[model samples]
Target: MLKRKISDYLESYFTPNRREALLITGARQVGKSYAIREFGKSHYSSFIEINLLEDSIARTSISKASNSKDLLLRITAIASQPLIKGKTLIFFDEVQVVPEIVTAIKFLVEEGSYQYVLSGSLLGIGLKRISSMPVGYLTVKEMYPLNLEEFYRACGISDNIFSVLEEAFKAEREIDSIIHRKLMELFRLYLIVGGMPAVVQTYLDTNDIKKVVNKQREILSMYVEDISQYDINNKLYIKDIFNLIPAELNNPNKRFILKNLNENTKFSRLENSFIWIREAGVAIGVYNIEEPKLPLELAKLRNLFKLFSNDVGLLACQYADGIQLRILNNDIDINYGSIYENAVAEELYSHGLKLYYFNSKKQGELDFVIKLDDKILPIEVKSGKNYLRHNALKNVIENKDYEIEKAYVLYNENIKRVGNIVYLPIYLMMFIKNREIENLIWKIDLSSLPQ
Candidate 1:
């Protein structure tokens, strides 16, 4: 099985002496359950699995049991499996169906019998309904769709190559053209298949883009179904917003405008719908920051924001009918800037960065703004090879008012540095993190390049 970065964290969570019950939450079919199960089977002497959504008796047992010990007894009875204190792993999948099970986690951790791992889709919605949170007891982790690095691993890329790329990235040296082209090819595939485990696996197994997009559509349908089922009061509004993302992103500014949806529609009226979609993990919001400065969240204009699908492939699938094929064949004539921008957003978000953008009325709009140490870095995404003419980025960096030291322009180009701005290929986004940005500098060895 292809390893996920979260797997290492999960392993550490189950180390020799661990206490807190684990709660894994993310969108549906992002491999939360699969990761937990894989970890359990390999790490534990015995593993007991229960699906609260499918097993009513298990749900009833969990809800009715007065205490942790009683709950264990009920589980033992249902599974007819012995619960070894330290060697057993009890996994509860789809716990959102019975959120009472989540509340019971406090007592379960207190019991200190078997190690527990709970995973559920739409967990954020369930969490709102939770009476008492397992504040001090549960260890929570949010899983996202497979990132580029993980996707590379799934494609059986070598670690040595990745290490080489990392080294080049740190030195800000352009890689060999051949290697760069190869990675770009892989990145194009990633844009189509996305980071969803199932979709990626389907692509790997069949090498069929048609099958891959079919799976993506299925997942999109599931997201719509979730909206309909979970937010019944505003299902239409939520679906409308969801369906409008592709068009919204394709706009010049890419800011989500409620007026576009409906001239009379105010952000306040559909705030819950936005909240529901975000909480469900189907979409992410990038708020507009009026000023670019440290503590980017403070200057955020909540009403002014852009909405990106959690996965780029989904966004691509929604861009137009048969658009994925057009993208793959390079046959489409329209600008695909939104798809590339969405992919960058997903990469940044998966790295634990909050999304924010800066737009100056005088300077123009920058794609994203991220905080690195005490410096505010402005990132601009360009679809084509037009890496120059970054008026917005140049303005932000040059403006003494902002005092920005460095800026980034992600595009389809080899790595290079021009003054304070760094140009990186979009695929290299997976290598960027807040801690490492300080070491990332342009140090081109011109002598090494072929003349």
Candidate 2:
């Protein structure tokens, strides 16, 4: 089994003298259940697993229990497993379907008989329906699709490769050409296979690109089915927007145009549909920031935004016929710039960065805006070879109205510093939050580097 970074956090959570019940939430098919099960088997003496969606007996028993002790007794009786303190781990998979089970979590934590890890696919939506949350009693964590680092590890890539990349990034130097090409090859595969555990696993098992794409299509179908099953009222509207993401992103102005969906469509009417898709973890929204400044959320123009699929591979699957082949063969002739931009957004979002973009008719559009310490860094992503022609980034930095210091331009290029702007390969977006790298970029004298 491939290791997930969340496993390390879970290990610490279940270490000696645990205090709170754990709640793991993420999108469907992202491997919440699998990761929990793996952690349980490796860390616990005895693991009891219950799927609320499949096991009615466990659900009824849990719902009927009066207190923590009663709930433990019911669970033990139903699961036919002994619950020993400090030795047992109880996993509740898909607990979002049962609101009563969620309510019991407070009592279960207070009981403290066994460590608990509760996981659900649609927990975000379920959280809205929850009347009383287990505040201050449960530790919460969100699991995303496997990131680039995790994907490389799953493919048995050496950690030395990443270490070299980190060194190059900190020094603003290019990596060895041979190593760079190898990493880029793996990155291309990542674009096709995505970071979805199921899709990644299929690719690993077969090494067949066609099989991987077929699995992605199935996952896309499952997302639509999930919408139909959960949001019956807005199923059509939700599906319409979901399916239109590729088209919306490919436009010159990447902001999702309401007119494209329906000329008469009002954002107010379809707001919930958008919320449902985002909360479900199937998509991420990048809002337009009218003023690019600190406290980005406050400056967001809610109605003006672009929606990206949660996984880049899924986006590629829906893009067009033979697009995957073009991407694989490096024969891409279409406007595939949005695909790389979407990948960058997906990576930054996985690292817990809220998505925002700055668009100005006068100053060209900036792909992403990130706040680092006291500085608001503008990130421009170029999928083509012309990475140096960043007029928007230059204009944004030069504007006296906005107090911008330095900017980052991500493209298919080696790491280098040009004036106040740093050029990085798109794959290195994963390291934007590294402490050492952040410090190096902030303190380095860009004047020392040749233009």
Worst 10 residues of 1 by lDDT: 325-334
Model 2 bad stretches (over 4 Å): 434-451
Which residue pairs come into collision in candidate 1?
Answer: none
The number of clashing residue pairs in each candidate reads: 0, 0
Please state the error at residue 109 of candidate 2 in Å.
Answer: 0.8
Tell me the tens digit of each residue's lDDT in model 1 across 1-451.
6689989999777876777889999999899989888988888888999999888888887778887778877889977477788899999999888888888888877787778899999887889999999888888799999999999889988999899899888899998899888888888888888999999989989999889889999999999898888777899999999999999998988989898778997788888888888888989899999889877888999898999999998888886677776676655485878989999999999998887998878988899998866678889888775669878888888889888888888888799999999988888888777774456687878997789
Best lDDT among the predictions, by candidate number: 1
Show pairs that collide, candidate 2. none
TM-score of each: 0.94, 0.94
* Per-residue lDDT over 208-298 for candidate 2, one digit per residue giving the tens place of the 0 to 100 score: 8889988998999888888888888889999999999999988887889888878998999988988988988999999999878878989
| lDDT score of residue 368 within candidate 2 | 94
Give the alpha-carbon lDDT of every model.
0.87, 0.85
